[model samples]
Target: MTVDHTAPGDLAPHPVDLRAGELAALLARAHNIPADVHRLPSGEPVVSVYYGLVVRIDDTCRFWWVVPASVGRRRPLWTSATVPAVAASRIAGHYRELRARPPGHLIRGGYLTADVLMEHHTASAPI
Candidate 1:
């Protein structure tokens, strides 16, 4: 795991606003990963593209998380935006439209870049 020396800012938590059925459908269609939290032989937690990406809901927040493979991990990777309410009710329609194209997750970036900016900064085009 890599370390970010930067401190995380306080993000205002959001509540889960979708109905149970809608939430279930999104999990079925978009990202239906099993979420049995498990540990490595060394006693570190396991996290991976297939085994990770756990979505959880509480009274205060509906959040996605990447369970780290080690205890030293301060935080798991996450989406920048909370699960939007409309996504649940409207995502089926979006999925129908996207049926023709390759699934979004199947598409990988052509290459990588080292555009490491501080939090809240935008990446500018190089001259």
Candidate 2:
């Protein structure tokens, strides 16, 4: 999937404002990933992933989590090893799916960086 890399302001705006609950439901259904939603210290909604990693939907800074290379090892409690390529493809696909949906104000504001998306795709591809 190719992403248009124009500035965030260039995209057409979303029709509706989405609430946290709505965002949570959309994400769960779209990505098949369960996320625990919470409020940030600044009051923005955040979704927590594995290993205490938190992603704030409202804040652009914390949206993506880079799965560490150590994840390939059985660290502490993790059993299966996570291959970087597999994880990257999964994440890139998820973002692509989200981007295909109807525009949303908050979504436009919290758009993922194209470089990050492409990195995942490239890293995940068979060498």
Candidate 3:
């Protein structure tokens, strides 16, 4: 089976698909964003992390937050050809928000919606 790497908004296949080791190295430096590189059934490497952040490198080496379909249909978060560090920082913040959310807020089973991932958490929100 051919695994399509075209994310929601892309018109064609991405030219630069980071190898597993390269993806792992980027995540390894992100101390707070617990992540691991895993292969798709088609053998494509994807970086999986908490809060349903399954990242893919594409569109000339940019980072994208690929959302799981079980949760929602929001567009993936694309970093637009920026450095990995910027993507890492955004991912770290995204993780923090998801971690801070109150139980049953936007999580279902073991998955979460991209909408909740982008929402701002308030100080008064119950954890």
Candidate 4:
């Protein structure tokens, strides 16, 4: 999916207070992964800890990391050889906490909308 790029100040209807790099660092430090933080062409920070994984933390501080659903289904959810176990567990806990609340709890500044989650779910479902 293409990321909508507009001036950070003009993009979101509301102020985006979170820094992607900060969130990524927090997650990485919490999980103990060595975070390789880089800025996208649009200046958004993209953190890569493992070879095949990339996490994009939007302006709102919500995170999205790409991983194979089959790998996701395995034990100690979110574990990857590329990510430290502590980091994986932290990420898993983040999702667990988010899942406990209504979807609205995670929504902020129009980033990571429910539609995105739905689309990811639909796309990842078995054929």
Candidate 5:
């Protein structure tokens, strides 16, 4: 498990606008994507989806696509406030697009960045 050193005042409380289990159910029912909810060591709930993607709720109730990394902080694909069903569809589409990519293809530029980010992440992802 990774250790967080941020003081309590600086730390964001566990998200209340979104719950992991509820999002998982939404993903399954709306997008046919089977998602799993797991709690962080800090007790924050997160949703694990296809292609090792992670969905989390920030303090403001915005959904975040977080890339898990062994080193450095987790990266966010995007942060925005949206309905659960829309978020589920977007996550599912991203998963499908990732799965559709051919293996060993050239990785460059932003794609390369994303690939490297993926490598750094997923080291401890449940999916």
Candidate 6:
């Protein structure tokens, strides 16, 4: 599906449709944020050492991703996206590529919404 290009400032989030196996594999190879560096708890730069993220994939090929609002918190805020299978596969593929890259490359400074996944959905995203 094509991504909506409206500005992100007023955008709302729904559920993130993800490929389960793809998401799991991505987390397996992802790195945690360093404690020394201060950063936002949500949106881009989410991976942390304390607790991992949650993901779900459906037969329709839609997927959802959820992460705790705070470190080690049980409650989570989730976001869904409208991404086609090819795009989803590409996202998974990027993680796979990163698995071979250094830790610094895994740090993602991006955002996601219901209709739009990220800048990469339409163009290239710095990995």
lDDT for each candidate structure: 0.32, 0.39, 0.53, 0.45, 0.58, 0.35
Question: In candidate 1, where is summed lDDT lowest over 10 consecutive residues?
Answer: 111-120
The sequence of per-residue lDDT tens digits that candidate 1 reaches over residues 11-59 is 4323243322345555465655222323334332222222122233333
Question: By summed lDDT, which 10 consecutive residues of candidate 2 come out lowest?
Answer: 75-84
Write out the backbone clash pairs for model 3: none
Candidate 3 lDDT, 1-127, residue by residue in tens: 9999987878743344444345556556755455776645544445666656656554356566633332354533333325776667666666665666654754653455323432321122122
Identify the superior model by TM-score, candidate 5 or candidate 6: 5
Candidate 3 lDDT (Cα, 0 to 1):
0.53
Tell me the lDDT of candidate 5. 0.58
Report the C-alpha lDDT of model 6 over 71-113, residue by residue, as the tens digit: 3653434445435344344434433443454444233422233
Best by lDDT: 5
- Give the runs in model 5 whose Cα sits over 4 Å from its true position: 1-18, 66-76, 102-127
Please report how far candidate 5 places residue 105 from its true position, in Å: 8.6
**Where does candidate 3 stray beyond 4 Å?**
1-20, 66-81, 102-106, 109-127
Top TM-score hit? 5
Name the Cα RMSD for model 6. 15.9
Error of 6 at 4 (Å): 46
lDDT of 2 by residue, 97-122 (tens): 44445556323433333333323333
- Per-residue lDDT tens digits for candidate 4, residues 103-127, read 4533441225323432443344322
Which residue pairs show collisions in model 2? Answer: 85-124
Q: Residue by residue across 1-127, what tens digits does model 5's lDDT show?
A: 9999889789764555246666789888877878877665555566777444667665555566743222353333444445777777777777675556553432421233323334454464332
